[model samples]
Target chain A: MNQEQFEIYRHLAGRLIDGQLSPGSHIESEQELARKFSTTRMNAYRAIKQLERRGIVSRSKRAGTRVSAPVNPNLLRQLKCEMTRRICVIHSRNSYEYLHWTGEFRRTLQQALAAEDFTLEDVHLDDVRDRAELKEKLLRLTETGIAAFILSVRGEEDEFLIENSDLFFQYHNKIFVYQSGAMSWMHWPFHTVTVNIFGEGSLAAKYLMEKGIRKIAYCRREISSKNYLDFNRERLLGVEFTMRRLSDGRNKPEEWVGLEQIYRNCMENGSGCGLIVSTDELAARIIDYFAERGAKRPPEMISFDNNSEYDSYRLTTIAPPHVEMAQTLGRLIFDNIDIDSECGFVSYIKIDSKLIINHQE
Target chain B: MNQEQFEIYRHLAGRLIDGQLSPGSHIESEQELARKFSTTRMNAYRAIKQLERRGIVSRSKRAGTRVSAPVNPNLLRQLKCEMTRRICVIHSRNSYEYLHWTGEFRRTLQQALAAEDFTLEDVHLDDVRDRAELKEKLLRLTETGIAAFILSVRGEEDEFLIENSDLFFQYHNKIFVYQSGAMSWMHWPFHTVTVNIFGEGSLAAKYLMEKGIRKIAYCRREISSKNYLDFNRERLLGVEFTMRRLSDGRNKPEEWVGLEQIYRNCMENGSGCGLIVSTDELAARIIDYFAERGAKRPPEMISFDNNSEYDSYRLTTIAPPHVEMAQTLGRLIFDNIDIDSECGFVSYIKIDSKLIINHQE
Candidate 1:
């Protein structure tokens, strides 16, 4: 068979073996298949005939072509084994933000990896009872020559991996640590990708100030103490630094750190000022405040993380570059480029933050 | 082997076959495993030996027991086949709310089904190119004696299923139609479950009124034209009906159906009144308004769909009972209870809505 014909056969067989198509089901007509593959009808027929010779499909005058039940299940196993290039995605179990981690980021990463012919397998570290089992799983993946590993984990839950960093030093190059927070350890030397939280704050500040606002308030809810690095503090510092630099160290924006404080500030001077919100959730509450007041024009506002749930609010937001980060990691895996060497001993990669305007897609 | 020993052996083998336990990886110590299973070390050791005998694991004094590479991959197929009780969850591809549908609901359903030793598999209808392919899939599943199927589809995307309703009538008993919107076809005979949108509105109005709300307003963003039933309109009707009945047909709440209208209403007479919002998102904007005004006390507000993203807003919301619905569906599967028989020809089930106060866990 020609290369294109061979590809058609492989694609059809792969779909069947992957359970995308069921046994004994009527296959699409040859003309439809040809249209689908952008191939000639003769070629599609040839592919079907090739499958028929192997007992994979049967053609009948009365019914048309139909997929047959596998005569040998071993072929399924063999086909599965042939797709050995896999990227292992490891994460903590029972993560409250599990959905967030597995949502857009996971989908984008999976799509990016699939484009490179690498399958993504999820391995929950806490799914197993003990640290030993987790280690064993990692060891097995490395032994199997897995292409790359992405560690998408949260605070404290990542303690095991951090503690065992030395053990993984041998395969450090193959590991990518992805966390939204600031990196705690600089010495581990594993390839790291993190959302530029500080940059996001700066971007929000810069964006709002450039819009020619006379005054602004930096609003945040009470900071959670659970994180190893205070992301809010870092973000606040970024905003403060930018605000100072932009105004030649002559101006400081208001900081509304708690609900009561925010309320007091809004009550006293909330009108017509630019606002830099810490997160989308916080921005949502602020939007509600202005909306209820029946303000003719809502204040110029910018927040971090463009959550789709808050899309209608039309709040411009500094969003984490999830897709860009995913694609960058994919490039790292396929190209085997050493990030540290490329960046003069910078171990971690800080993906530039994104500013989504008025919730535009 | 005793029953406990057999269970331990089976559990280990299942883990191995499921790829939860990696091949050639060191197994947890027998004592630790015994502690885990609450069994004696002797039983655990006996189970290990049984696995060793079957060439699934190997034991050595120096390195301890290790899972062995599968000598016969056919055993994997046999074990997989043994899990014949499966629920197929079908949805549209490129569904914008795909994550929402697949997130909490899918997880809860999977957990509920797993409790009954059943597995859930996802099938995207739009992934296939043609209706013939889709029909073939359903036919194959039926031929294989599949346990159940859940159709979690949106408006126009469900046209194919609705059009082919006659073809599916024979398997109506095993088909479940799950949608948040109102069902368009009451006569389809497939078991239906929908969120109580009207009841949610009534409950919100009732809850606010009972709390001595002097004035209440039913607030909603612009109603989308996409839905089969005007959910917002129904919700408003429920609120109005409840308001009038509670106040002896004398009181009617204000209606703010659009953003501009809501803003005008809030600006004119928004304060010190309870608000019944159509969604958590709209409620967020209202909350933001009050917070900005620096009102010492926020207005009593109730909204629909207790989205976690709006948890901080602390708006009392009518939440779809996801876990309860999942459990109910699971019970339906296990008992094979015919709804039509039990409810006097009522084929559909309405799971009660939940009211979340201040985002309580």
Candidate 2:
């Protein structure tokens, strides 16, 4: 942690990079390093662990640690520049859509960094399945020199990661790109990008209504996070707002559709109904579920994520501006890294979603 | 190149794995090994490179070379088992369907291995844009230690990977799992998991016929690889087969729609047409493109991949038996690995596609 220790590690890393230390060559012992750098053995060990994590060195119990000679220099240089500074991209495995977006985000980031003469060594950590595992992985990355991380915090996991923000920032300055928008409650020194879920919902409703669909139903997941709760509420309000202006006195604008009941009704007779789904993939399933039971097709349907794998169904839906979000985040990270600014505040960047109509209606 | 050198390398590898040579400890120099084994230095160097590629050794100009300190020990051990040997999984960018199937295959393989106290290690290679790159990456894995590789060979790039099958078999025997019914011309000694592309095409044609959609249109990328050509031919045959069957001495199936003309017609009058797409993503885009132009919605539409992403749009489709194929392949690999016999061929596995009808029709 001190400047002297940092300099010593840097010098050793430079030697390893230049092939001077040579992979398989035993690195100077902790005592030798301590004497050379005028540091404690503990500090030297810590530095060695850091190098090992970076894939710069290989350590074994019987074999003294040595620089890894086979480390791709190009990959190393890029990783050292991008990874050592600290940043993480996190997401859950539950939502294939989210997993995909995360992959794209990482790919775009990698491409962007390569363009700027940097390399990104991705550290994939599974979503916090349990509090202990979450804390351990988070701490490991932060303590080992990851400066910033992009995390898709969802449900209760949001609170746990946020509660440990101080611990994370202690190891290095952190930047969080919150995908689910729950970070609004946290006062962390990070930036966030989120889908305009409420806006998307309203757009879906409007598209359905435009096709003379009055009895519109909204289907969404149970809200576990405050942001998702707000999103659900806001979407309802948007649907209500549009319906109030366009509806006749007899019919209300929007109705809550229970997950279980929707399938029964869809199978019995889906005609004269319009549905606004939370996601394109879910909508496709609902459609399949109904068709399996020989249900009439709805006049209009709206879903989300035009680029979803199910796009073959040609669902009219709302699509997130993923490329734009990626570009924006890349710019922000580069700017922050360049300036080395101390400002720690959350800046929410909101982008618009597009409505795509398909043949299936 | 000779059997003797192969024997030597195999002996050294066994010692390395048994910890006779500690990780980060240098092995005999190339010249020394050549003299000791009465072989050329090139053979020794090749062996070293092979070891290096397997993450068993780290080699460099200065560091000399040594075994890699195992990072994922359990993973490495699982990889060493003979039963888990002849299996590989390949992936591509934006090809979520293929990637998802690959993941499923890996999981199935793992489960099968776990039942027999064995597990498999996945060799993931991505961003393979061309044949040269694909062949290079595949050969690298095979030469290192992979016994089999599963790849989605479609297009000219795939041809390159297949063309070099002799080189691949020279290093290690392999089995390639391609897209459904994608393999046609057989030049290599390999088994394939054929998808029922003809069946899917037949089903699509039948569905269109039932709907009285005489003016049917088909859209797909121009065939390049032998697999694609086969898939295209089968689909066309299915269409012709259906039309001939349905013809009651009066009406014939409509002309095969061309992409350029389809785009023009959809732009002019999007309604009153039936279309079958190769993929859900493309179908979604076509729908969106027409909607943006204020064209009327089509009467009937069918797409592929009952993937969740397309749920938003109520579209009829045929879902590939991805999970089934993965499970089958996993079982096959597990069985082969367990046998560990030099007798190297397995019967080709074929999976059927299921029709998933939604509100789209």
Candidate 3:
């Protein structure tokens, strides 16, 4: 139930899964493991006991302890087969707790993978109380064989991968990160599944432009917070690329136009401008904002991220297909799991988003 | 019934899956599509009609024809959820027929993915009767969105990947291949799931050595027939690396030694030599060969591949864990399916085999 038990248990189990701890091999005693992990002896013993419950280890009073031999290939297979493999989303405690967007993504991701019998849990493994706890969780996550992670690493953890790539690579191939629209490509070197914001952005622009809206505007989220804005700029870059291609570079949407000004200008002029907001939430907000302003109607609008909130608008949005992404993500991850060692090139698959005129997740 | 219908169907479905064919867009009429594909009109109509069956397209006398707009996201998901995802093993007809070994691997792979609801079949897409059919099947396999493949490339198909990598890359991230031990490294660039023949070879050497068999012998099948000999040399390299580490390598088994000579020397010397054969079949032949020579008993023996034939001896074998490999392959393939596009390098996971003492699968 506590972090200590979970940490110790996950790391040792990971070792077994990675073949780092061979079957029937003697392991560091519970006492030795506790000292090694700088945890209380009780935590280590509890961790091993958890492994025993999973048929990953065996213990006896007469003999000390060891990773149990695979009982029989058929039985070992059945034990593995009977269980559903878990995939967790590892995010900072703040992101999971405070951010509505992350929660939305988690819910959507779970819905996506649920069909495949994959359970996506919110894992606050990195949010331990202290350095020792964090160390234990990190070790457990990287070493324990229990589950794979969809790591949304922020701030220091990005630095952690750079500093400890080998220890990370020991279990690196097992985890996945989202492709972000961040300016810095720090996580570019690792395994990533991302929406092609650039391509989708451009494509959406072309599609919207063809609908005959003369004035086009771009909307954005407030960047006052520094937590996870990596994709913010990239999303715009995609939109601008499309604008530059279609129109004379003369009257482009100004950089970082606030929603208030955008709403005011379009309403005052009664110009049915084509608006590209950062998300479906913003799209709904603008429509509501116009209604609140006593305007009879709003401008032609489109948004990104097909969150379920936009279901009522019949709104046009440039949204990453979550279930399709999950399905593709499933296909991509499973495809490369076999070739990670031999193929050194990271494959950045471009997930194309569609311009949905109506409907939602 | 013919390759054209299959190709036309798979390719259009691929376009739908890839978003190239927008939902609710007017597609080429059956006559147009048939003309475009250089096929009979009936074939194209059948292909499009098949798409209609999948809820992808809708046809009527008044509406003409178009990609069906998903009436509801939940309903669309339900329709997709009803489908069975196919994972195929692509091979030449010659390879599938003459070599029964590939059948064993296919069975193991099926058993492994069976739990995940994936049915594995040997897809002879490459074995089409003619060159045009081969072209159609190859294009269909790579570009079609219907199924993922486990490509067992041999002779010409390896060259096929190099020649048409773009079309291959279009959907190359969707299939799987065995991690092979070929010295050329030609096949490593593609997606592969393979047994760690080298590592398993090394560990088997060490295990038999510890059990008191000093002089190690390596046995192999002939490469003249050109079947799946991916791990042929690497298996020996593993044992040799271990032998060199354990003792002087002056008397180690030479490469490609015929079974007759190896059987004669071990029987004549009575020096209790440990053996590593290519497979359980070769091991059975060796054991039976010894029996024909009037030896009192079989030498201390270990073999590769845990096919059920080795069961009676409780034969120690160096065979890659088919089910274990399957388990790992499932995890590996599923793990990387989501991340292949983000990761730059192809992941070749090193699959570890075990020293099975008293059983066989």
Per model, the share of native interface contacts recovered reads 0.00, 0.00, 0.00
i-RMSD values for every candidate model: 32.9, 32.0, 12.7
As a whole number from 0 to 100, the lDDT of residue B21 in candidate 3 is 75
Q: Give Cα distance to truth, residue B285, candidate 2, Å.
A: 65
**Over the stretch A46-100, how does candidate 2's per-residue lDDT look in tens digits?**
7777777666788887888977747563334333443364455655433443633
Interface DockQ per candidate? 0.01, 0.01, 0.02
lDDT of 1 at A279: 74
| lDDT of candidate 3 over B1-361, digit per residue (tens) | 2457766775775566556777788878888888888999999887777667656778889888888865343322222322325666665443322332255556666776676566765666444555456546755544333346565543311444323332332333455555333322222234444455666677778787777677777777655432235446556766775665455333344553667776776776575777777777787887777788776445576776666755775677755544554555576555444311333233444456667776443
Model 1 segments more than 4 A misplaced: A1-84, A94-108, A139-145, A154-173, A224-229, A286-298, A337-347, A359-361, B1-361
For residues B1-361, what per-residue lDDT tens digits would candidate 2 score against the true structure? 2444554566666665566777667887889888888888898887666666556778778887776765344233323422233355554333353524555655765676566444354554456666567557754664345545665553223454555443343334345555454433132334455555555666787788787777667766544656555566656555555554454323333433344555786555445667777667667766776687676456577877776777887778887776677666666554454322333232344456778988744
Q: What is the lDDT of residue A238 in candidate 3?
A: 58
User: lDDT scores for all predictions?
Assistant: 0.63, 0.57, 0.56
Best by lDDT: 1
Between the candidate structures 1 and 2, which one is better when assessed by TM-score?
A: 2
Give me the candidate number with maximum DockQ. 3
Estimated TM-score for each candidate: 0.35, 0.36, 0.40
Q: How accurate locally is residue B122 in candidate 1, as Cα lDDT from 0 to 100?
A: 76
lDDT of 2 at B322: 68
